[model samples]
Target chain A: MRVRTESILPYSLLAPTLIFITLLIVVPIFQAFLLAFQTADGEFTLTQFEKMIADTSFADALKFTFLLLIFIVPAQVVLALVMALLIHTRFKGHTFFLYIYALPLAISDLAAGIVWLAIFTERGFLNSGLFQLGLLERPFLFLSYQNLPALFSTLIIAESWRATAIVMVILLAGLQVIPRDYFEAADVFGANTLKRTLFVVLPLLRPSLQNALIIRTIFAFQTFAVVLALAGRVIPVLTGEAYNWYALNRNANIAAAYSTLVLIFTVIATVVYFRLLRTSTAEAGFD
Target chain B: MAGIQFQSIRKIFGKTLAANDVSLEIKDGEFMVLLGPSGCGKTTLLRCLAGLERVDGGRVLIGARDVTELAPRDRKIAMVFQSYAVFPHLTVFDNIAFGLQMQSRPRDEIKRRVEDGARLLELSDYLARYPAQLSGGQRQRVAVARAIVMQAAVLLMDEPLSNLDALLRLQMRAELKRLHQEIKATTIYVTHDQVEALSLGDRIAVMQNGRIVQCDAPMNIYDYPANKFVGGFIGTPPMNFLPGVVRVNEGKPIAAVGESHIAPSVALASALIEKNGQPILLGIRPENLALASAQHANTIRARVLVVEPLGSHKLLTVQVGAEISKVSVAPDQRVAPNDDVWLHFDPEKIRWMDAATGDAIHPG
Candidate 1:
């Protein structure tokens, strides 16, 4: 059999990335598995798993993580799609709106959490504004443990505001790649704007939507700083619990166990999104 | 089918006059071709009629209604784009049925119309196939089928065959002409290819710089163009031009070329009589120039420069003073390069145009 240099050259070029991934990702995942299952004396043990299951906040963390995704993903998807469509309209000042819509993508998740922390503080803008407008008689305690709904609502809003921009940018790229003739053809065919968006834009935007959903869901499961900054342990999410176990309790084994749980949950959510949004190859004209 | 009337239609794009005071009336069921080179606003005028482009001035009437401000959907027109903008995601049947569905037609009616269109365009077998699975010719047929299935008041084709290969273009051109005859819909076709324009258009509207220079029957435009640009633009190998001054000899108008003088044809001579001492452009087609056996009244003595042998006929390039004129000779007629020949211009075939304005000096 003859070997070609062209075929082997690509693999050689990919060698550095393969090595880095093996060292940084593959080795760490293996070490995490070992740490979760074994004791410091190197004996196989179920001690960390028992502790993880018995932790008082474990069920709350898992449930709240899923709840956050349920709240944030749909809201962000709707907001991003609307923003993308507005930009696609190319009205006057659309460029200005495009820059403003994508501005939140530049802010880090920690910074975004801190930014919203200022808004939801007891004497922050919301409470002061409500009091000045006579909507309230006094400043409200928004992030208190007793105000769980307000705390959760504020977290959802902050996450949606900070993260929807990435999805909007993705959808905007997808919208721009669609040839203008399709829309013109639809118009000449007597399709109203709503029908055009439903039958033309959304179906064509399926791949981008799938990608955005999967990424957002995975990140939603790992949400930490925003919940921490706003609620201060009042809200328990998966990554927050993992941070508490490692940073506060100083237990590496339990932290690794929590991390594994987050990973598993992310993978499951990603799979569910794939199954729900999958475009059949035949329908996409691949066949 | 409905007729189209554009009264002083004007369109401006930024600083460019895309369609400038253009007026045309296309009869119902007539195939009118807007013919010009690129950037001459032929497509812009077609887009205006389709209501895709908003005219800055004047009125557009389709049938009896004014449609200048109406949306493209309300204009009751279907357009086939140059790129064959058939929806890629839809099957052939669904693509053909799209316009009807938009109109909220009954399901059975839509199905019957789509099936009929598929049969007409020979696309019945490919009804279930997506556009990506079809060949270029099939995709174009699907586009045409979609347009005709709408049964629009007018059909607009913007260089629909420009994307196909040579053989496919020829085949589709004939198919389109047949389709027009079968459907009998008023179609405004736009093309830059003179052959397509001349072959397909019942009336060819030649445009230049956003203005319709001449609109007339294809044969009339071919035989007697209204201006020098039309004359040079219409025919294959183009009409040959010779610069000459009009002079009187024995009370007759003679086109004087340096040391040689040929009397203008009677019809042309009358138009040139009053314009004596002014330069005129003498226009003749290549086929109109014949080999003169001996010295004749309207013959110019010249030397053959190059011989281009086509399959059926040979083209002889002859030098008449400083200008070179092509004369088509029969294949059997032996001719070689650099041979002295006396070429006679058919009297009735000569065209006299004003040199400055380029307009034909037609005899009253």
Candidate 2:
């Protein structure tokens, strides 16, 4: 009787949280799916998806999103790993350094993009510093059409700087859970710094790395605010393109289709990431 | 195998001295145990030998190598931690093979060595299993296998069997002794358990307050402790210390504990000469005290406070004046709480110490 009541207590306690999640996540997701299949006349149709695929902006948006992911993912992972290692070393003022590194976590993505824009703008800090140093004859046009590489670099840097803290925190937590004895044992076994980091620390940190990868990849797919703050309507990303189609052009049907596509891409990316993690991590016996 | 030596090694953590000017020589292929209470610097000394801890002063040498400033990787030593410290992510085979792999030994050689260690430890079937999947004893065995496969000159084990259950600990203790005998490596084992130190070590070093109080064979330490601390630490039920007045009666020394007095043994009488009329502690082993029917010479009459029945022997706690001393008797001996008994001890088995300094006054 006690066991049965104990089992029921959890369900009763979790009922409120379950209801809240259903209202917040499940309701909106179901509405989005409903909207995706509905026509302008409120009739069920596949025409919106067909029209969405035929739009040239959709292809360009897809290409730009992939490019952003390609640039940001590796940079963010590497930076987060370095930051985690630095914090793990317990140097002087390490807490202060960690706080400084994690300060960007509280800043809005749009605000970070605007901050980067101030540096990368034609009349911004970079050009003024160069002019003061006499490195440039005049203010360099960093965000100009001729400098596409500079624009891409600025976008990648802004995203990486803003988002790497979450991964760093996760990796730090992973590092904290690894027993000090493991490191001492490694030391006893004659493992040097590089070998210890690569063989012991990396293998143990696999679970955190996998979780960080999946979360960052999903967030990368839906990246919008930074691109909008940096280039506004000049540069089109997937979410920005969808916003333009739905709110500016007044095409709810095609916008829903674009939203559905982003959702599909997110699911696919998450599945692929987890599948890769499952295979490699299982082979490594990381769990 | 290497003979280990610590030459005035000291470790200070901030203002506190964890290990202070500790110096000792451990003979090659000798199983020397550093036995002490917790936080008495036994582990610190072990870590110093392994180079895991940096000494604030003096040098540490293994077989003539001045490894005082060397990193642990350069020290050529293997340590089994109290936690066993098995790599959780690695299989037992991989965990055992870790040291060899880190050294970048040939793959076939690593495989053969790990397999050989596993077979020796009876962990051959569990090689593919991870540490979490194995029992505590299995994990501890894997830790030993890992250290053994290193073929290092010195094996530093810090309470390696402390985490196991009592039965498992006893079994593993025997296994460890056998393994040591087979390997014949210079092993420095650390434990607070006197029984373990006495049974397993060739020579036991009893430490207190960062200094070695005594370093000798276990039986010698038991029979003749250099100081009160070693005498108190090395015995089970602990050597009982009774405050008594020493006096010279007809030019013969006698220790007076409460109303009863006993003649001093020759070994104790000479040391008590300087301590005449001074308050001293009389050290007697519980096992040394025998129950008698009548008042034997050097016997005290007391009422039993408690009776603890061990399978082989019974422990009787008797109140002699203000002090209570425990006496061990055969389990077959009929003794009960509240029973009046006469406790007799041989003078030859008694140890005398200065109460002020807690140092052995007799056998000096």
Give me the candidate number with maximum lDDT. Answer: 1
Alpha carbon lDDT of residue A48, candidate 1? Answer: 94
Q: List the residue pairs that clash in candidate 1.
A: none
Q: What are the per-residue Cα lDDT tens digits for candidate 2 across A1-287?
A: 99999999999999999999999988987777777898657789888888888887777788888999988988898889989989998899999999998999999888888898898788898899999999999997867656777777777877888899988998898888888898889988989988999889888888888888888888788888888776665556788888889889898767878888889988998888778666344345554
Model 2 C-alpha lDDT per residue in residues B130-152, reported as the tens digit of each score: 78778899989999999999999
Question: Model 1 chain B: which ten-residue window has the lowest total lDDT?
Answer: B258-267
Shift of residue A102 alpha carbon in model 2, Å: 0.4
Q: State fnat for each of the candidate structures.
A: 0.40, 0.59
> For each candidate, what is the lDDT?
0.89, 0.87
lDDT of 1 by residue, B1-364 (tens): 7999999999999999989999999999999999998999999999889888889999999999999999998999998988877887678898999899988899999999999999999999999998888889999999999999999989999999999999999998999999999999999999999999999999999999999999999989988998999999988889988888999877789888666677766766677888889998889999998997677778888899999899899989889888988899898888889888888888788888888889988885
Best TM-score goes to which candidate?
Answer: 2
Docking class of 2: acceptable
Model 1 spans > 4 angstroms off? A1-34, A37-50, A269-279, A283-286
On DockQ, the candidate that comes out on top is 1
